[model samples]
Target chain A: MDRFRLPAGVRDILPDECARFDAVQARLRERFVAAGFRFVRPAGLEYFDTFAGADSPVAPSAMFKMTDRDGNLIVLRPDMTLACARIAASKLGAESAKLCYFSDVYDFSAAGNSDREIAQAGVEVFGEAGAEADAAVIGFAVDCLEAAGLSAFIVDIGHVGFYKGILEESGLSPAAAEEVRACINAKDAVGTELALRKNGASQRAQRALLALPSLFGDAQVLSEAEKLTDSPAALASLLHLKQVYALLSKAGKEKRVSFDLGTVKSLAYYSGAVFTGLAEGVGAPVLSGGRYDGLCARFGKDLPAAGFAIGMQRVLRALERDKEVRQ
Target chain B: MIRVALAKGRLASSCADLFIRCGIRADILKEETRKLVLETSDGAFKFFFVKPSDVPTYVEYGIADIGVVGKDTLLEAGADLYELLDLGFERCKLCVAGFAGVRPDPARPLRVATKYVHTARRLYASRGEDAEIIKLNGSIELAPLTGLSDVIFDIVQSGGTLRANGLSVLEEVFDISARLIANKVSLKTKAAQILPLLAKMRGELAAKDEV
Candidate 1:
């Protein structure tokens, strides 16, 4: 019966949509290349353990798994940009590298959930660290979104350490900490308070935890958040975000930028300045990226770096909607 | 223009009252003849009446620049829209309820009936309990009584329904009140109009607090 309709969440990106997808991909590639990022392509499949570290949010069940020739567990690459960084460090020995790619990632959960395969076109800069690199990546993301005709959007900025540092300092058990992280990520304030209370955290910690969701706004959120965190690392992260904001202000994209201490990255690999571009008419983020200093280390290279990825599917969705409205 | 999607129920009526307090006419809301879209006289705003669950989707997709929906809708949809203000209306609580004393046990895979599968899954997962989720469209409270589920995940405003049915809330999951959510794009593109409207609403809310 029509080949079972390609499963519920998986479908063919028809010629019409693919044409627009390719045009967007080409525009991003040209812009990234002109900005001096070398193009790189990673295998669409990798060993499961390669993404099992602290930086990956890929659940094992979410991956399309298979047995390798050597009987090792392998899975289709759920995200090419991260795998690209892994390859750049291990295969190319490029600790400090700038790479751009256009590829489809296979996520099994996409079937019956969102869609299994996603066409993602974006850039990754490895080895460049600090506020300068963060600004550059965010600036590039802004350029890509604007280029795709998403003129009305905001780039929300946050640092992974901002929340992680506080959670670590809460003296929670590993399991409890993970639960708390999930709660905070979901913007479930009541759940967070209950989790913290059940974990027997101090009253001060519980109060601070409950306030996490409301601690998001413009740049002032940084200073307000700094007062809540006792961890030095968390404070340093706040300072780093301030420096990045200054850089964006100099670049004149500061108005388009907002601060969110509660903004959590979808991927576990983001280490600093995690951000997502939001626009009207799209159900998800148009673009997302952050600094992943430890990701390169996973591929046998130690380097500080930051980068961002444009969600081709979501961008196309916004563009198509805009076109429909205009017509 | 700022677009607000109001749930077509008690929350919508309450929101209309708040809008009137904030200097919005809100008379268009009274002409309820299945008209989906309504525009204010000043032509600076538009409102869409939609199902509470669909309000988040509309706001998240930027179809309506903003939305006035209960926190329950936000939790269920899990849309990435920016929740800007707590309108403090339609207040309720999401809870787990079952036959009086048949509490949640983590060891066994409990079956839960709910209209909010995402929220239920997350609630159980957060508690380190894995429960088989059964998604139902309506009358969730009837599931446990009918033996279709071990427990029911639903919103409780006063716990009257549960108590009347010989059930009690085993655990309260979340405190939900109505909130103002903005589409990430509309918040920026229409900032000149949207921000002022938001400021007015905030001013009115603050005044209410003062009174």
Candidate 2:
């Protein structure tokens, strides 16, 4: 009998699939380079601490791990863009760096599901923290999505400070605050209410927490959220989003933009304006990115930066479906 | 045209009432027939009466442009759909209930019975507790009393059922209400129709609160 086949979750991206993937990556890469983003590549595996210290969506178990000869823990990179950012900040010396990357990230969760190794093609613009940089990155993302043949989608924007400000004001214990944050992030209104109530939060705080999910939509959500809280951090975040939206609007990308005040990107990092691109055919986000002004500090470098990653697998799925529809 | 998946029970009735209050006719929904599909006179919309748990799947897969479902089902199914609005009706709470003083140690693995296996699993995992989940399709509150499991994860609208069964809520997992969900695709393609309807519903909900 032939040797047991590859795991169920992981699938081989045969020649045809590879062709489509490369087509999408090439278009994105060309656009990034034209926009002044230099190409950078990093190893598929790195010391485990490299990820442990950074804010990433990948869980530890999702990473392929091993012990080196020197008894050091190593992990097959579950994400490339962030690791590359770390490398650029530390190795390349982060004095305004723009890096574009295309690499296969080994994720164990994908191993028995579908496509164990994902070819992620994305760009990271480092050493810029202004609203203009935010707009440039988002504009590049919109161009990339369209280039990859995703026309009908929305770039839902939010800020990390909005959620953090509410939690800080609630005055819950550290543990309770974490629970509330997780619930809010999950959009679990009921869980959030129960957690806040159990933690002895005031009725005003509870109402504010419950309103979070609804506080997202169009440009008007920012103004409405600003009225609900007195925190300057939240106000600044909303203003930053307004500026970014204004810039995108000026750049003629307003129709594709929307705002989501409840949008939370990693539990840590993401100091401002987090966003995800969603199209009709795919269930998961096709692109996810936000500002992480503190990420460089993890690698012993202080640089304010922001970038976004296109989920090549998800984007490919949407493109394939779009193509089928068109055909 | 817009398609709305309505949960086929009390929640649906309440949602239909809200739509009627918002000036949309809903006589077919009130007729109490076993019809699965209904269309408006203008043929601009359609409604599919689906099982509550299946509503999210319908919306997520784009079979339905939108859905009216309880938060309880949304949490249990964990489907990826955009929750566009909270209807604020059909309120309830998910709780871990068992015979009084039957608390199992956090370290010791306990057996949980529920129709919501995923939600139960997540609840236990979040609390750093381990439990073997026994999934039952109905009468979950009877599980512990029947000695089938150590606890029953069920939605509680009131404490009466638990109290009558000599059970008490050990830990409240989540609070739930009805929500309006939209398929990601529908939000973009049918925004002209869907957005206005969403705005109208929001307005009606606000007006109701003021009264």
Best by TM-score: 1
* Candidate 2 lDDT tens digits, A44-127: 779887777434546777788999999999998887655866787789864888888887788776521136677677787778
- Per-model DockQ: 0.28, 0.23
Residue-level lDDT tens digits of model 1 in A89-202: 787765467888877788776521145777777788877877888888898888888777675678888888877777667878878877777776655565677799889876
Clash-forming residue pairs, model 1: A55-A268, A55-A269, A110-A115
Q: Pick the candidate with the highest DockQ.
A: 1
Candidate 1: which docking quality band?
acceptable
Give per-model TM-scores.
0.84, 0.82
TM-score of chain B of 1: 0.93
**Model 2 interface Cα RMSD in Å:** 4.6
